[model samples]
Target: MSTTNTDVLVVGAGPTGLLLAGDLATAGIDVTLVERRPHGLGNMTRAFGVHARTLEQLDARGLADELLATGTTLTTARLFGRLDLDLTRLPTRFNHLLVTPQYEVERLLERRAVDAGVTFRYGTELRGLRQDAEGVTAELTDPEGTPLTLRARYLVGTDGHRSSVRTALGLPFPGHSVIRSIVLADVRLAEEPADVFSVNGSGDTFAFLAPFGDGWYRVMGWTRTRQVADSEPVDLDEIREIARKALGTDYGMHDPRWISRFHSDERQAPAYRVGRAFLAGDAAHVHSPAGGQGMNTGLQDAANLSWKLTAALRGTAPDPEALLDSYQSERHPVGAMVLRSSGAIVRLAMAHTPLTRATRSLAAHLVNAIPPASARAMGMLSGIDIAYAPAPGTGRPSGRRAPDARLREGRLYELLRQGEFVLIAPGGPAPALPSTAPVTAKHLIRATWTDPAKRTAVLVRPDGYVHWTSN
Candidate 1:
C-alpha cells in the first residue's frame, strides 16, 4: 500500500469536483481529486443550458467567453401550449442562456484546474474511508488494482447520486420517483428549427426539443399510453416518433451522440456533512431536469463551499466547524426549493386533465401579461436569484451574489479572477487588516460600473457572494 497526504481529498472528477478543485487550488490549497473513470471528461451531454448565475461564477474564473463560443446563445426560451412565456425579461447580463453540452463545460473547468496545479488522479476509486478527530483516511484502488491510502484534513463527496462517501456515512437519501420513465436522445436533425427550444403538449404526451450547434438537437418526451414495464427496453425509434408527432415534422434523426432513459426522482440527503466528510452536488440532492438546474445547481454548490473551506484551512477567521455548518444551512433549503419547483414544472407539463391544461394555459398568459412577474419567475428557474444567509455572528449581507465589477485597473472580471476573498473599498482607503487575516483585501478608490458605492467597503467570498459590506 502507498500513502499520500493532502489538505482536501475530493472524490469524483465531475463538474462539482472539478470546480471545487479549481477554486481550492487557485486559493492556494493543496487538493487531490480522485476518479474511478480513466477518462477525465465523460462522453455524454447529460446537461445542456448554462444559466445566468452559473455564468457569473464562471466569469469570475475567466472561462465564460470561451464556453459561449462553443455553443449557441439563446435570448428567448418559450413554454409550449396554447400560450407561451418568453424568458428574455430576466435581469442579467447572461439573461440569455448558453446551450452548450455538459462535457464542454467540464473540459474547460478541468483545464483551469490543471493549470492551477490541482492534482488529478484518474482511474482511482475510493473504496473506503475512516475519520478521526484530526482528519480522514481514504482507501483507494488504482487503475492497476493496487491499493493506496491517503490522509487529508477534509473530504468532499461530489461523487454523484449513488455516492460511496455518503453511503459510507449512513446518510438517508429520501425521495420518490414522480414519473415512471422518460426518454432522451442527442441526435442530428435533418432540418433544424429557427427556434432554439420548443415544447408541445397536446395529449397524454409532451415533448421538448433544444437545438445545439451542428444541427444537433436534444429530444425529450414521456413514454406513451402504455405503462412502461421495468423489463422493457427503451426504443430510440419511439423517442424520435414522439418528436415527429409533437413537432409536426418528419425530420430524419441520425448519428446519436447519447441515448438515455431517465425517471423524475426527487431525492435529497438528510444531511450534507458527517464528521470530517461532506457531501455536495448530486451527492446531496437531485431533482427533475425540468428547469435544467442540475449541473448549474451542482456548480453553485462547489462555488459556495470552496471559499469557506479555503478560509477555514488558512485559519483566517473563526472556527472551521461554523464554516462547515453554514454550507448546509444555506444550500439545503435552496435544494429543497429547486426540487419543489422542478417537480411542479414536470407535473404541470405532463398534466392530462382538461382543467389542468386550461389552468396552465391561463397561468402562462398571466405571466406573459406581467413582465416583471415573468422575469422574477424566470430568474428563479435560471438560478440567477440565489443568495446565501450570512454566517452566524458575522454582520454580513444576506441572500445576494456580489455583482461583478471592473476594477480600478480597468481589468474585466478582476475580482472574480483572483479566487480569493476580495474587499472593495470605495470613498476610502482599503481597511488595514492584519496580514494574518484569513481573507485577501483589494482597494478601489471609487466604484466601477457594476459595483455601486452603497458602502465604504464590500467583502466578497470566492463564490462571488457578498458576505460583508460597510457604509
Candidate 2:
C-alpha cells in the first residue's frame, strides 16, 4: 500500500520494455520499469539475428558499433531450401545480418536506461491496472509479496506472449500453435559450418543451428512424431538424430550446456492500445521463428512506440491523440504481415502433404532464378523494404523510413541521436518555420528528397520515419 508516481510506467524488462524505457529516460522523462524477474539480463537467449533496419535504428542511437564488435556479420541468408537472400548489395550501411544472443541486446538497452537514471523495480509483478482521464494506476506486488500502487501519465506493456497487462485490458490474442515440442539446446559444435546459419527440414522433421559469435552454438529441432508435454525431458541422442535427419550432418555436435523444449504459436493482440495502456513486443504479436524476426519485430515496436509516448506525455507534440493513435494504425499491420510471412515459411519447411512440398520446391527454384524476385525477398526478410503508407491526405512519401545519407556536417543518423524530429533542407537556406513547430530544422544537409526536383524540405521522425515533405 505504498504509492509512487512517474511520467511513464513500463511493464516487463525484456528487449521491448528496456528499449522504450531507455528512449523515454534519455528524453529527460521520468520512467519506471518493473520486471517480474529479479535479474535484468540472462545468459540464455532465443533470438540471434539482428536485421538491417534494426541495425540502422541502433546506429541512430549510437549503440550499433559496440554490438557489431561482439557479433558475427554475414551478408547472405539462405531461405526456403535452395533460395538465398543476399544482403551484400542491400542499401544500408549494415548490409549484413549480425548474429548474437538476445541477451546482448538487453544488456546494451539496460545500460542505456540505467545511465539515463530510469528507476527499476525487480522481482515485481503487475496485479492489475486501471486508467482514467488523467493517467493510469498500476497495482503491483514486490518480491516480498508486499502490495504497491503506482500512478503514471501512461503505462506500456512489453511483457511476453502471456501478458498480464493485455489480459487485464480484456484483449484477445487470436492465433494457434503452429508447431509444438521443439527441442532446443545450447551446445558447442565439434566443427562449425562455413555458413553462418544452417536450416533444413522435410516430411515431419526440421532443424536449424546458428553460432553465438563464440564457439558455442544454438541448435533447434522439431519432429512431428515426438509431440509430447512440454515438461517431458528432452534426450540429447534424440535431438542429435532429429538434427541429422533434417540436416545432412550434425557437424559433430556435442557438449550440451543447456537443453529445453518449447511450442511456437502465431498470435497477435487485436488492439495495441486500450485507453491509456499500450502493448508492445511479444505482448502485441508473436509468430514462427523461421525468419528470426520475433525479437527484431518487438524491438522495432519499441522504437516506434517510445518516441510517440514521449511526445504525448511531454505535451510537446502537435496533436497527441493523432500521434498516439498512429501507433496501432502503423504497427498492427506490420504484425499481421510478419505472422503471415513466417507462418508460410514454417508451413513450407514442415510440409507433410505432397502438394505443399511440391509447391514449396517450385517456389524456391523460381524465386532463385528471378533476380528481381530474389532481391525483393531479401529486402522483406532484411527489413530494408518496410515502408509505411501515408495517412489520409498526407504526402505519398510521408510515412516511409528515411534512409541514411551523408550530410554537410556528418551522417544522417548522427543528427538524430537527440531523439527529435529532423527537417532536411538541402538546396539552400531552410524554410523558416514557427519556433513552436514540432520539428527541428537542419539546413545545408546533402541528403536527397523523395522528389528531388520539387522538395524544399523533408521531415523525419525521431524513429527515422518520414512524417512530411514540402514540395
Q: Pick the candidate with the highest TM-score.
A: 2
For each candidate in turn, the TM-score is 0.92, 0.94
Give model 2's TM-score versus the native structure. 0.94
lDDT of each: 0.78, 0.84
State the TM-score for model 1: 0.92
Which ten-residue region of model 1 has the weakest summed lDDT? 441-450
Best candidate per lDDT, number? 2
Cα lDDT tens digits for candidate 2, 50-121: 989899989888999999988888877775457677789788899988988888888898999999999999
Every model's Cα RMSD, please? 2.8, 2.6
Once superposed on the true structure, which residue ranges of model 2 sit more than 4 Å away at CA?
40-43, 432-455
* Per-residue lDDT of model 1, residues 73-129, tens digit only: 777776664444455666556777888889889999999999999998999998999
